[model samples]
Target: MMINSTQVSYFTLSAYFDTGLFKYLCFMIVMSLYVLIVGSNLLLVVVICMNRSLHEPMYLFLCSLFVNELVGSSGLFPFLLVQILSDSHTVSAPLCFLQIFCVHYYGAVEYLNLAVMSYDRYLAICYPLQYNTRMTYNKIATLIALTWLCPCCAMVVLMSLTSSLQLCRNTIYKVYCDTHSVVKLSCSDINVINVYGLIATFSTIFGSLLLILFSYVRILRVCFSGSKQTRQKAVSTCTPHLASLLNFSVGACFEVSQSRFNMSTLPNVLRIFLSLYFLTCPPLFNPVLYGLNLSKIRVIFKSLISNAA
Candidate 1:
C-alpha cells in the first residue's frame, strides 16, 4: 500500500498546547503532578524500607509497587513534560519506538505488581499462619523479579516485532507514544502483529484482573464469616487496590478505544483532556489512595513524621 507521496521522511508534531497560556498552564500542572507522583512514591518506598516493622512480605510488595510506579511514570513523564512545554512535540523514529517499548514494559509491570500485591494480601489475610512460610524473603524476591521480568519479556517481543515493520511516515494522533498509535503507522502487513499485540495485552490485563477479583471474593467470604470488625478492616485494606485497579483499567480501556476509533467526534481539547487525565491521574492517585486509606501506611507515615521531628 502506497502512502501519500511526500519528500518529508518524518512527520513532526505540533505542541498539544499551542497557545502560550495553555502551554504554561499545562506545563505547571503536569510538572506539579510529576513531582507529586515521584515524591510520594519515593517516600512510600523509603518508609517501607527504612522501618524494620515493615520488613514483611506485604510491605515488600508495597516497596516493589513504589519502584514500579516510578518506573512507569519515568517512562513517559520527562519526555512528555518537554513536549508539553516545547514549541514542537515531534519525535524521531527511534525515539518513538523507545517510547512505545517503555510504556508497555512498565505498564505491564504495574499490572503484574498489582497481581503480586493481591496475592500477598490473600496470603496475609486468609492464611496468616502460612504467610511467613509461603512468602519468605526469597519467595518475595522471586515475585519482585517476575514483576519486572514478565513486562520486560513482553516488551522485548513487542518491540522486536514492531521494529521489524516498515513505517511509511510517522503520524501520531495522540500527544504521547501509544502501542496502537505506533502499530497503526506501519506500512507493512500489520494484521497479524496487531492481532497478536491485542490478544497479548487484553489477556494480560483481563487475566490478572480476574485472578485479583477471585482472590478478593474468597477473602471477603472468609472475612464475612468471621467478625464484623474483621470484615471492615479487610474491606478497607482492599479499597485502595480496588480503586487503583479500577482507574488503571478505565484508562487502558479509554486509550484502546481512542486508538481503535477515530476520535474525531470529540473536539481536540476534550480529547486531549481525557487522554491527559487517564495517563496522569492513576499514578498520582495510587500512592495517595494507599497512604491515606490504609491504616498501617498511615501509622507508618505518622511514625516517619514523629521520628523526623
Candidate 2:
C-alpha cells in the first residue's frame, strides 16, 4: 500500500533505542547541551554586536557563524529532547518537513559562510596593505547576503521536492528528520530528485570547498615566504577557521556517507554518535575555539565578566 504525501500524517523515527532508566539521563544531557550551545553562541553574538571596535569583516563573519550555530542546534535539540522522552518517537508531517528545511538550510549557510570567511582571511593576510580598501562594507554585506539567501533558496526547492513525493513508508531510520531518509521512503520514482539533490549537495559542498581551497592556497604561499609578523598574523587568524573547517568536513563526510551507504554493520550507538557529531560538535567547538584564540573577543569577554562581577 502506498500513500501520497498528504495521507502520510506522521513519521516514526526508529533510530532511538530504549535507554530505559537512562532516558531521563539522556534528557538532562541533551538539555544541558542545548543550553550551552545557545548560551555560548548568543554570548559571542552579543559581544560582537555591542562592540564598535569589533565591527570588522572577520568579526562580523564570526557573528554570522555563531548565529548559524544557534539556528542549526535549535532545529535539532528541542525535537531531540522530546523524542528521547516520548515513548513513541514520531513527528508530524509539517514539523518533520520544517526540521528538514532548518537542518539543510543551516548546513548550506555554514559552508557558504566559512567560504566567505576564508576569502576575507585571504585578503587580510595576503594583501595586508589594501585589506581595508579591498574588503569594503558593501562587499561584505553582499557576501553575507548571498551566503544566507542562496541556501534559503536551495532549501526551499529541496523541501518542495521532498514534500511532494509519495512515500511508501513513513518510518525514518534516524534520530532526526533528514532529506535522504525521507527520499528513501518515496514509492514514486525519485531519480530526478536524487540528481537534483546530488547537484545541490555537490555544488554547495565542493563549490564552497573550492573557494576555501583557493583562498588557503594563496594564504599558505604567503605564510611560507612572508616575514615572521605576517606568519604570526596568519596563524592567529587562520587557525580557528582551519580547525573549524576540518572538524565540520569530517563530521559532514561521515554523515553523508552514513546516509548514502549501507552502514548497518556498525553499532547503533556508534551510528548515532557519528550522525549527531556534525550537528552537535561545531556549535560547541566554535565558540570556545574563537573565544580563546582571538584576543579581541577574549579581552572583551573578560572585561565584561569583571564588570559584571
Candidate 3:
C-alpha cells in the first residue's frame, strides 16, 4: 500500500452503533464487563493479600497474575468503555500515543509475568528439592522485578520506533490503539520497518509461548513418573495453568492472524474480534484461572462474606 503524506490524520470511527437501541445495549454490556473484570481481579488480589496461607510462592504468583490483569484491563478497557457509551469515537494524536503506550506496556508486562510463572512452576515440579532454596521469597521478588523490567525494555524499542513515524493524518479503525493501526497511518514508506517490527513482536510472543509449553511438558513428564497421589495433585494444580495457557494460545493465534492478513481483505468486524480476543479476553480470564480454583481462595472468600455480614 502506498502512503499519502498529505492525509496527515484521519479522525473517523465506523458507524458501529447506528441504531440507538443497539448503542445503548452495547454500552450497557461493555460497562457490565468492565465492572466484572475490574471487580473480580481486585477481589482476587485482596484475597491473596489478606490470607496468610496464600502468602506462599504459588499464591504470590497468583497475586502477580491478578496484578497483571488489573494493569492490562485498566490500560485498555476504560477508554473503550467510554467509546461504547458515547456517539463520538474520535481520538487525538497525543492521546493516541498514550493509548498505544499503555496497551503495549501492560501487554508486554503480562507476557513476561506469565513466562516467569512458567519458570516458577518448572522449578517447583521438576526440581522439588531445590525449589524452596532456589525460589526463596527474595528470589521470587527479584523475578517479579525482572518481569517488570523486561516490559520497560520492549516499550523503549516499540515506542521509539512508532513515535518516529509520520502518521499522515489517518486515524485508526479499531476501538483501541494498536501497533498495526498506528503503523498503517504513517505517510512514509514504512513497509520494511513495519515488517521488521511485526516480526520482532511475533518472535517475542511466540518464543515465550514456546518456553511455557516446554516447561509444562517437562512438568507433566516429571509428575507422571511419581506416585498416584503426587500425580493427581500435580494434575489438579496444572489444570488451571493449562486453562490459562489455552486461552493465551487462542488469543495469540487470533492476534497473529489479524496482523498477517491484509487489512482490506479482512472485514472490520473480524479485525475487531481478533483484537478483543487477544487484548480483552485473556486479561479477564487470568484471575479466574489462578484464584477461583484454589481451596484457600474458597475459604477466604467465604470468610470475607461472613465478616461482611
Candidate 4:
C-alpha cells in the first residue's frame, strides 16, 4: 500500500465549536483535562519507580498500566486542544492516519496490559508457590514487549490498507481521526479494512477479555478454597484491578458501538460527550482507583503527601 494524494491532502475535522467564546471555553477545559491526565498518571509511574517496595510484579504492571493511560491520553488531548483553539480543524493526511494509529495502538496495548495484569494477579493468588518462578524479570519484559508490539504490527497493516483506500471525501464528523471514520470516506470497497479491523479488534480486545475472565474465574475458585485470611488478601488485591478493567471495558464498548452502529437518534451533544468520555474517562480515573484502593500504593502516596504537607 502506498500514498496517493489525488483524493485528499487533509481532512476537515468536526465543526463542534459554535462561537469564539465557546471555543475558548472548550479549549480551557480540554487543556486542563490533558494536564491532569498526564500529571496524575506520571505521578503514579514516578512513585512506583522510585519506591523500591513497589518493584514487584504487580506494581510493575500497575506502572505499565499508568504509562499506557498517559500514552493513550497524550495521543488525543494535545491535538484536541489545538483543534479547539483553531478556527479550522484540518489535519494532514499522514498526521491524521498517525493519530489513528497512535490512538488505536494505545487502546490495544491497554487491553493487552490489562489482560497481562489479570494473569499476573492470577499467578499471585492461584499459584503462589510457582508465581515467582513463572513471572521472572525476563519473562515480564517479554510480555510487556508483546503487549506493545502486537498492536503496532496490527495497526501498521490496518493503516497501510487505509492509506491505499480511494477516498470519496475529506471530512470526518468527529473531534479525532479514527480509522473507521476515515475509512468511511473512501470510495473503494472497505471489505479489507472491515476484515482486518475485525481481526485486530478480536485479537486485541476479545482475546484479552477472554483471558482476563478466565484468570478471574480461576482466581475466584482459588479464593473460595483458601482460608479466611487468604480470601481477604486475594480480594483486596483483585478488587481494584477488576474495577479498572470494568471501567475500561465499558468505555471501549461505548466507543466501538458508537462507530459501528447508527445512533443518529442520539443527540449530537450526547454523542460528542460520549466520544469525549470514551477518550477521557479511563485515563483520568484509572490512577485514582489504583492510587486510592491499593493498600501499598495508597500508603506510599499518603506518606509522600504528608511529608510535603
Q: Is 1 or 2 the stronger prediction by TM-score? A: 2
Candidate 2 residue lDDT tens string, 64-147: 999999999999999999999999999999999999998989889999999999999999999999999999999999999999
lDDT of each: 0.78, 0.94, 0.74, 0.86
Q: Write the per-residue lDDT of candidate 4 for residues 1-309, one digit (tens) a residue.
A: 233448589999874656667878878888889999999999999999999999999988888888888888988988888887878889998889888987898889889999999999999988888989999999888888898888888988988899998987887888889988988887788897898889888878889989999998998898778888779877888888888888878888888888889877988878877776757998999888888878899899789989999
185-239 per-residue lDDT for model 1 (tens digits): 6777988787788787887787788779888987988897878877776778778
User: Which parts of model 1 have CA positions greater than 4 angstroms off?
Assistant: 1-11, 14-17
* Backbone clashes under 3 angstroms, per model: 0, 0, 7, 0
Best by TM-score: 2
Which scores higher on lDDT, 1 or 2?
2
Which scores better on TM-score, 2 or 3? 2
Choose 3 or 4, whichever is better by TM-score: 4
Supply candidate 1's per-residue lDDT for 80. Answer: 81
| Residue range with the least summed lDDT across 10 consecutive positions in model 3 | 8-17
Q: How do the residues 1-309 of candidate 3 rate in per-residue lDDT, one tens digit apiece?
A: 344654444344452445566767877877787788889989888888887888888788878877877777787778776777777787666667777777777766667667777878888878878888989999989978877776777677777787678766565666777677778767767876677677766766776788788888888788878778767766667778778767876886776666566665766667777777866787677767666677778778888889999
Please report, as a residue range, the 10-residue window in candidate 2 with the lowest summed lDDT. 1-10
When summed lDDT is taken over every stretch of 10 residues in candidate 1, the lowest stretch is 1-10
Please report how far candidate 3 places residue 24 from its true position, in Å: 1.6
